[model samples]
Target: MSPTLQNEALQSRAEALGQSLPPLLAEAEMLAATLMLGEHGRRRAGSGDEFWQYRAAHQGDPARAIDWRRSARSDGHFIREREWQAAQSVTLWVDPAKSMAFSGGRERPPKGDRARLLALALAVLLLRGGERVGLAGLAQPRSGRSQIVRLAARLAGEPEAGDYGAPETAGMVGHGRAVFVSDFLGPIEPVEAALSRAADRGVRGALCQILDPAEEEFPFDGRVIFESMSGSMRHETQQAGELRSRYLARLAERKDRLSELARAVGWQFSTFHTGAPAQSALLWLYRALEGGR
Candidate 1:
């Protein structure tokens, strides 16, 4: 590309990002406001510092673990237990692939937009709860309102040139959790490799597959030209409807594979469509993280 063309492309991308950033941030905040804030309770006693509850002292309970004052008030000896605190660092990855920019119609936003919204909203809740959140491979995990702005800017900046996206796991926090948002239309090797690396580091997380309604329902009929969002792959089919079965089959297979991979690595997996409300996915991600603890 010529210098003039490259500059023009950069300017266009900047303008697009500027246009999208404010609404994305506003929507994320609104979505996050609907949820309760504070550190999520693990509901079980472990090695955490925060006191969860007082239970009757067990036969084998250590003398130091007993609460003498509480025991005096109670008929039986009591033990103060601390809640389990795990997954301190949460890394988020929203797919930057051009395919994630696809939307089925004017009514719904792009898959990438939904993914970013979910990621940011979840971050807001996590940050409020004192969890460090960051963009995978782009930013170090930090907790603050400022991190939300940093994430939104990065998410709206530019689209990657590819048909699909892959997770970046090199700098993953050991024993920390991660959330990866992608369409997962790419080959399975990259996804498998990334999760394997994460597992090796004792990192477990969630995989959110964002898709367009058209991709799942296969509403196209008759002749259609199917081209990738990056314009790198294309196919002209006279009987688009006839290929629906094969396309749906492949999609199901991919989803099954993702689910299996997630299970193998002790992670959670979910599928969300652009047509649905974003809050549901955000809620699911929040609960999944809390449950993992």
Candidate 2:
């Protein structure tokens, strides 16, 4: 197929992915099952084994007098109902902005593509596990698995997010977890600020920094022109060897800074390369957040 046609096909697939399960969706299902093995009280609602506080026996109280054991001990019969907690809510904050589309060296699925895949996978996993999910992108407020297909379709048609990005805060609701999936290529301060805001609101979050393998290895040989993914700037490289050290140092610093930020704020942070299997990355992310302890 033609280049445009190929891209369109990929787009269509990504969108359908939200509602329709992919062949490899089993991996995500595995992760979800692992995360929610014993978790309950949300997806499947039924009379649970939980015993909450007793309430006043209202009119037409059961003859058994709920908490009859306690009533025999005392004098009053009180009705007891299980405290039902809604399912754990998880928000998939995907950086649907255009910047995520960068492919550092050669033609490969861009970082943005992987980001979308991760977000959708996570959402599916959570949904399967009986959790409500929220979505944020260069756009915002993509919520609920019911809307997953449409959200994915919209993201498929979206352009690369800008350097200065927007955030999704309005739709974040209920108590649960938040997962921010992005390369976070723009200004560091804003990204930190956004995370801080989420943290402040008691929204626990994790950050996944996606990168291209070539970006780290400095694979360009002789001469190359490097363009910024956000269309902000470009760099010309005469010899990749000469810039190797600088590139590595920057990479190291970025990793350290991200790790430190996550540590200080109690959010999990992880980095993944494009060539790495994204399913493995999801596992690694869960491990990092779970502390392996």
Among residues 3 or more apart in sequence or in different chains, the pairs in candidate 1 whose N, CA or C atoms overlap within 3 Å are none
Write model 1 residue lDDT over 210-268, tens digit each, in one string. 99999999999999999989999999989999999999999999999999999999999
Clash number for candidate 2: 5
Residue 95, model 2: lDDT of: 71
Worst 10 residues of 1 by lDDT: 35-44
Cα deviation at 200, candidate 1, in Å, is 0.5
Off by over 4 Å in 2: 1-85, 104-107, 137-145, 164-168, 286-293
Candidate 1's C-alpha lDDT?
A: 0.88
* Candidate 2 residue-wise lDDT, 186-271, digit = tens: 66786777667776777766888888887768776678787766667788878867888887898888788878877776778888
Q: What TM-score would you give candidate 1 relative to the actual structure?
A: 0.90
